[model samples]
Target chain A: MNERLTYESLIAAKLEQLAPLPALADDIWARISADLDREMPTDESEAPSGGGPSLPGTGGMLWPGLGALLLAVAGLLYWYSQRSGIPVPAPSPQSVPADARPASSLPADTGSPKGIYQQPAAVARPVEAMPVPLADSAAAPSTGKLPPPVLPLPDDSRPQPAASASQEPPPGQPPATAGDKASPPPAIDTPIKKKPRGVTGISNNDYRIVPDKKDSARKKN
Target chain B: MNTPDEDIQLIIDGCIANSRKAQELLYRQFYGFAMTVAMRYSRDEMDAADILSHAFVKVFKSIQQYDAARGSFHAWLKRIVVNEGLDHIKARNRFDSPAELDQAEEVPVDHTVVEQMSAGDILQLVQKLPPATHAVFVMYAVEGYNHREIAERLNISEGTSKWHLSEARKTLQQLLQSHR
Candidate 1:
């Protein structure tokens, strides 16, 4: 306790005996007033010296103006999504109508331009989820075993389709023409339909189903 | 002319009303006393200035909460300044790392040596202490905060606060001995 008293008193006396503290009044007030101006910005009487006079309040329309701008941006986005035929995700899943589910839930309209683009996404599902035609089972081999299901490879490993007419189609799909083979497939999952290979008279060798290139070109034009 | 107390009361009322002139008056009135407190906790004048600015801003923003009956205005202002200084030290990431606890045994200082040194000389030596030690010493020796209050403020145990206080005295004693 004596040690504490000794040092504490000594330091206190020295601090008191020193010359008066330097005046930082003006310097500190300048800085603090600037900070005060920033915090209480609505206090026009306190705006920093040399700054332009405070502008009159806009009669509290700032929020309404911001709300209108936000609404306009939302309207524009909806219009663009409709014009481009790109589906806008509904804000709430419950608000999405039964018929308005993703394109994957709709029938594969192999005939429509929309279907052509959406087919690859459908094909990208796991093999078990794909709809195998009932006829495929009857087309199995005599030994009572089905042929191996064709699996899609990742893009790096998939063979790049050429404009060759000789590329045989999957069993259910009609033969593709040279023009149909020339157009590139959609950049998503491969458009190749799964083949149940034991179907009679189809070659035992691998075959790729090419998307209808002629139709794709027609749709693009 | 109003008494100084009455004038300060009026200033406080002006501050609550968001009067710019009243705030400037209050800041000017207290600047020296507050800066002296801040300089003790800071490493240098510039840091002291920064702490003082932040503390005054707090004072203005929270002026509505200052109750005259609880304490004098200077006591309240001093509390805010000390808190701001501690915050500055914490922000610089300096309050946590102390030398191992075993190394901080209390050292008795020769009072004659400290008495001979001017405040500026002692302040420079205190600034040379590790940041955590500096904060602990100022809170304990100068500001009269007990170990428990220091611990609560710095978010350490009382034992740790005592350890830091010891560390500060040990370092300051060494510095003073070298000066002698």
Candidate 2:
């Protein structure tokens, strides 16, 4: 009779008796409230819980529109180039002229095919009127010599354009001291003569001479 | 004065109306029953509490969808709690591999032995069983789910469900014998 207590029957009997539960209502409700508050929308404006797919917006069109714009711009450029009949220079080994081969004058490593496409490190540009490069020309007589190094002019040493025009000798000419005979300086206190001129179109009638009142008073006294 | 069914119906209506007071009332009403179902499937009381709380949250969210014509709210709530517990067990990845189903040997227990045991003692023993076996045993013996239903819910074969049930029984019998 005691053996008749099967595991199923025993489990069923135990399950019938409600097991003592720890106080979980307040804690469980707190969790529920927190979770619900976090998930549930506060406003009625929330999208209905139908959970349907949203309609596409301009945001989706942006990438394709951008791609089309790029394609159109490229097509317009290609059309313009074709209509102009301008030969678009393609990068090719044969396109490089034999006379344009100055890469040997560059670094030894730059003599490679890649260097043919690359611009020389030093490009010849008329940066200044200074005779400093003449000194380099005086130093290097070789025709294959590299271009003279362009030295930066010091701000203080560089002559102002107006000062150079009025006072300095022309760039190509030597200084007076550098010549065979040194020129004498002009007298510092010499009063310069004033030359009155006439307007070319209106003749001398357009020129009105206003006398300095202070000068006139000094002369009168 | 409203009858118990009327009172419950009023509460249900309130819950559907998104009334916090009604939701709290419903949660408090079924907390014990929910905990009991959850505890049998969980590793500990905290785990059981977590399952209960999450299930109640689900209940509150989907209370509008609950149809009373199908069954009582008690059955509905219990089903939710049991499913929630099962989800937790599944998330633990306990059912990925099958347990030693063939090695389980049944041990006989006297009627006096189970009579002397408390529900808490039985729950402890059940909790000590392997996760899949514990779930299968609770579903078959306590929740009254058939082998086919258990297999469908657990995504296992009916034979596997029976094996887990037998293993659970053997483990429980051994624990009971040791306890005595």
lDDT of 2 by residue, B72-180 (tens): 9889998898899999998885654354343334556665777788887777888899988889888887777877798799898776776777777777777878889
Q: Which candidate tops TM-score?
A: 1
**Which candidate tops DockQ?**
2
lDDT per residue, candidate 1, A37-102, as tens digits?
A: 788644554442456653447436767988999999999977654443342221221222222222
- Give model 2's docking category: acceptable
Overall lDDT per candidate, in order of appearance: 0.66, 0.63
Query: lDDT tens digits, residues B37-115, model 1?
Result: 8888888888988999999999999999999999999999999999999999988855564443532355778888887
Off by over 4 Å in 1: A1-3, A16-23, A46-221, B97-104
